[model samples]
Target chain A: MSGADTVVWMVQNAGSEAGSREVRVCGPALGPDLRLARLDEERLGPYSPGIYAEALSALIAGERGEERERRTIVLLPHTYQVAEFAPLLAVQLGAAYIPSICGAGREAEGGGLRFRRAILQAKLQAEVRPRARTVVATLQSGAFGSDEPPASPTRVVDVCLPADMERSHERQILGREAAGAGGVDLAGAERIVTAGRGVGGADQVSVAADLASALGAELGASRPVVDNGWLPREHQVGSSGHTVAPSLYVALGVSGSIQHLMGMSGSRVIVAINKDPEAPIFSVAHYGIVGDLHEVAPALTRLLNERAARRRS
Target chain B: MLPRRQTGEWGLRIGVCIKQVPDTDAHPRIADSGRHVDDRDVNWVISSCDLCALEEALLLIEAAEQAGGGRPELVAFSLGPARVEEALRKALALGADRAVHLLDDGFQGGDALADGRALAAALRREECDLVIAGAQSDDLGQAATPAVLAQVLGRPYAWLVMAVDLEREHRSVRVLRELEAGMNEVLRLELPAVLAVQAGINKPRFASLRGTLQARRKPLERMDSSSLGLDPESVGKAGAGIETTAIRLPPTGGGGLLIDNASPEAAAAELIAHLEREALL
Candidate 1:
């Protein structure tokens, strides 16, 4: 609850009746008192940043006016859709915009709220303090642990956009398409060996592949490897790719981005090999060897093969 | 939307906002203040995603030229101290027709909101038909400036743009945006729009010898806060909505067992033995 008196929930484009019922069922986790509102797409049309920002800004402004003395914190789940429009909403409301925050607490000195966010590609953590009266924060995926909430009754409310609100003519959605074919399935793999940017280049990807073959593990790749065309899109493992909870996961030269960690942090046992001691991948690895993958990978491969040969003999 | 600025022959004018950040590969030390990275010995480079944004603008202009739409001009914009001029010069070498450096002490120590406001003022002066920027900065990764700039300028905006198709008429553009879970949404926006490009859209090209030499002679304009009619209170730390109080190394995960640095064979044997003990081999 973060010490909020009330929590208002909005389900983008959800129908009024169905939206209310759904909120009652799942909205208790927010707080004991709830206010549900819907930005019905049926009335507003397809997703547009301009329209969505306008509507959301108007709603939050109205709420702020009602809760003028108290601190107003607008919380949202960080997602692709929210990433596109939340900044604009914050600008319209003259609020601070903090994206991908992992934790929060009140400062002991001034009693001001502070946010924790990953910076420098998750290599460092930054403590952010908002200087504005209102704040719009987007929570990073899987950051805060879940807790049970007390049961509470929900009261639905209607938010009125300005009477002159008009559909934006600036943009129109054409359609959607799949980003890749479903050729690789990393979710069900018992063991995964992921190659990251430190693999050097496309020609060097064979080093990780050989290790994977020795371990009888599926070959996976961090976003950079796939982005650089070193691997196919289907092999990508991250928030935008496959989320895997494998028995064993080996990360080779992977400087773990937060999104990459979110996807594979559930592995039962994780091992990382990289040249940099400060790499973020080491933070999540159960066993880490800070050494050159070029030397370590081939040595492990040779030893594994020799053990296999002895077993056969 | 602002009226299109008049040009001699080419009507399409595209502006790119490039940011010069500390190289991600560099091991930056925290300053004594604990507020930001100590950049005294840092290697600075144009952020990777910003370079891709510049490449996308260059590609758009080239495509327009090939279609007989006349030669469209590309302008690059950036805000920072004098070192940022180097980044703008690099942009010129890569094919930007002109460069604007918002150089002023008043613009220092600002967060995304204040910086966006200052940039919007500078951009309004240019009245470009289209504005482009990287979706996020490599150092901060805030990913807020472009959207705030668009909102301040009252232009339609898109984030994480993967592909851009300019209409021959120069009135609108179709863009493909990357979404979560392997989904892509296609959108069409009228002219006078802002786009925050994602990386991996294109491989940015290097500057040729001829281009680098020519860049030295190209016009690079510097604009101070007063030149852009910006108030000191509205452009810097005074106007920032948020401040970074501290930056520290991230905490490590549980079960952290760091293998001792040794010969490759020795390390490999130890790792294998651990796997065998865990019955994971």
Candidate 2:
């Protein structure tokens, strides 16, 4: 637990405007926390730790009064320390964890949540009662809260290091720039015209072309298209590919593998056409056509062309 | 030249790509013919092991902020339906300040490969330094998203990342990757690399009431593929280049072997009899 006593987790902000400075932190104190009576405390650091302190000061002052009491706070110094610190972190949070349940079952389910599925699935049909205060949440990519508990941002405290930063490997984020101009962002697309194995090959993609052109939609390809080199790397879809949440997603000649299904299952409307009625793709599809794509494509294309032509006329 | 802090500290920006999956065990509903999972009733969760990726990113950001004050503001993102906003908020509860949701009906139909292309585009738009994800989703056994995303994005990436660290001022990162043979390969990538995370890689945090309430206030940005200008034919099952002939849960077989053992000598005779019965001898 990050120093329960307010004085233990103190460190200096070497990178701040104040060249040489020290700040005391007891735990991760947020603006919403309510341990101390006032925001301005004298012992936090030399000159209130600058902008870091100022921003925090304003944040905490907003919360008039609330209970900010935490049983414990697990302070992990860096990313590499999480694995080493998790067991103890769980302990500190008092998480009632059940392990053997899923560990043995996941292997059997082809690596999915085997144990949790049975337990939660059975109960989910019924109302899931809110359990305990201890919530096992996966923190996002960034965000280290304040140093103190909820008491004082300006309070200074000393700390004893648990384990020094002994990362076997060093890591950092340099900069992130887009590869280039966008063509088709399937994940965010409102409507997607997707082709599958049924499309046959590069020669058969014309069907998708027609449908996409008809709808004025972005074209997408399933995994097989990329593997066959019929579609570019950017067009593949599935759990292992781009997870799109579009409005009208049309599936042509695609069999629904669970892996592939997971990617597009979030769409609002799923329209699928395949000769095989039993193809898994139809299960999730809002509209399923048990027909040959070869015939369907030309018919649909002609109809769409007629509609467009009539609009021009 | 390496982008460095004048004071010898490294700054970091990290992004966590999360997927919301149905609680498969929930068996919410059966498809019309009764084989596959029904989309309407699938109870979803933030997904397994992906949280570990989020943990890894948050910690990296925290450390960077703490060490040199060059911190990463957390951005949690997901591509799914309108309902997935709840799942995205779950990430925010952990510490992310903002979320991006690609919640459009157009993305609903494609296969996995098509899905990867779309996600890569969203990430490209964000322009984040690092994109971390669970090595493989618990629902789907196909551990193919990361590699495909990396391929599409044209960025160097490592899968099954066991350990990740930004050391000695964050110029580059030293990564411990688990290769197929259970061997560990440690390499330093310059920066802005994708890391498909392993379970043992990090300990995820629990949401405090404060964080949970804060998530309600965080902003979630929703965008569509149309705005991104993607070709509609390239999404959903229609976008899949491959076709599925059929999907069905196979029949289970139960075979029990019987051993005839009366006594040691008698047992030998029984074994012979049993083997003779089964034609195993």
Candidate 3:
């Protein structure tokens, strides 16, 4: 039952509001005995992987001072950056890097630290142990409830971007536009209604959209829907797309490929509508309707809209 | 900004790292060893995202050619068993000028870091101005290789790039990166940098029959671990810092109650009632 004496939370403001949520979610993983330290991203400078890695290497090296038996856990907020940064930092600090981690706790038996991560595309969860003295990992969105106790009071370390650290002026910031030509923001949506290939055709997407409008939910879709150009890339939900943990997720005609499951598996309540009773989406759905989405979606929308109109009158 | 030299014979020497993966649509069977899947019978294809990287590389070369600039050489690279040659050949068929195969039995079962070290070594051997690779592999689903390779080569890198524009005269490239919540960050990078490409960047082109024939004559260089001068102790399973103890299917979802009403209205009514009963509405 070895325990870490200090845990460092690395938060990057990659031009998103999820930065603070990342800290709140990862805070509960640390044991009561562990001390907390934070590495805050102070600016939105052009990110050069080499410079970032060098700065982090220096930071970790400075922390590895006289304590021979000390163990440090570094937590990253986003999956993409974690995938990009964790391994490099791990090699630099002689630590073990794990990705898509969902939970962490003290091992029940050995008291050694154990982390849980999904493998095989969220189809399986594995308990991982670090073979090195330092453990570096990234937490999946929606893994931990955000309502947990506030993080411990800790020292905040700001990583100042060196002006000359841009690696021989090889990288520069050009410009950015909101994702999706339609500018859909799925992550912030409380409820999402997603369409899949089973929605039949591009014209049939309106059925799903109508339901979303009636329910006051954001419109999302599976990869095929986006690939087929029925929806923009930003509306896509899957491993390759955006990961969302909305309060309610209503999947229409979705067959639930493992890729799509990886994105919305964290939804608090899942309702699936599909004609195929054998669709994999039913496996995770709390409530399922085995009917054609074209028919069921319109009926559901009308029923809800009628109720709303009646209540207003 | 570095002063641009006169356009030479090659505008940009782009290197793309690719992988051959079992078709995701195939049902994966756990092998007898349980540590990995039995892929002997599965149909192999270029991992989906890698195709996007290839497409992006080809597009850059095409744009350079259309501008009447120097010709760009697109080289595809891969590290895996001999079966990976099929993927490299496909990249050549899709208009890559050449391919490099990092093949060695000793390289099997290596983790991302070990593989990245070997790849970085291979990339060092080529005179490339830009390196592009898929954000992650479909099988392992770990988006670590390109970034780690960038670290090993001491080059700047960006991942999940949605769009790219090259400024040949300025010796820099601009890219749009996808972030969370429908936002993007645009970055400009100097030449000789790496980019981990995401899908949906472009529609990948299929190989024409003539291109398929031409690919046979294209250069396909094969190199082994020893050829790359990698230390034997620093590669393969022994050098992998992480190990998978087991692989198993995820726990099944709690039994889902299905409402199979014959009529659409009935089904909608049942769904609303269920949501209300569960206090989910």
User: Top DockQ: which candidate number?
Assistant: 1
Each model's DockQ score: 0.70, 0.02, 0.43
Candidate 2 lDDT tens digits, B1-281: 11222322343556688888887434345456442456786778876668888888888877777776565666777877888898888899998867888777888744445666677777777766777888666554334455456655655566667678876454566777643211345656656667788655666788889999999987878877886567777665555432222233421111212222323333323433442354322
Model 3 residue pairs with clashes: A1-A110, A1-A111, A1-A112, A170-B190, A171-B189, A172-B188
Candidates ranked by lDDT = 1, 3, 2
> Model 3: per-residue lDDT, tens digit, B1-281?
12332334655688899988888655567777776677789898998889999999989877888877676878789989989999998999999888989998888877777788888888888757899999877777667888777778877788888888888777778898876545688988877889988777778899999989999988898878789899876776656766665566655555877887899999998998887787766
Task: Name the better of 1 and 3 by lDDT.
Answer: 1
Per-residue lDDT, model 3, residue B199, is: 70
TM-score of 3: 0.85
- The DockQ-based CAPRI class assigned to model 1 is medium
When summed lDDT is taken over every stretch of 10 residues in candidate 2 chain A, the lowest stretch is A97-106
Q: Which lDDT tens digits does candidate 1 get at residues A1-313?
A: 3335534453333532311232243344333445555566765567787887788778778776888775556655666777788899889888888888877666565456788899988978999999987788776766655333323445555545667898777888989997778766688899999999999999999999999999999999998899899998788888667878898999999999887987888798999999999998898898999999999999999999999889999
The TM-score measured for candidate 1 stands at: 0.90
Tens digits of per-residue lDDT for model 2, A240-298? 45668787777889876544665687676677777765565766675556667777666
Worst 10 residues of 3 chain A by lDDT: A31-40
Model 2 regions more than 4 Å off: A1-313, B1-11, B25-29, B33-35, B168-170, B243-245, B254-281
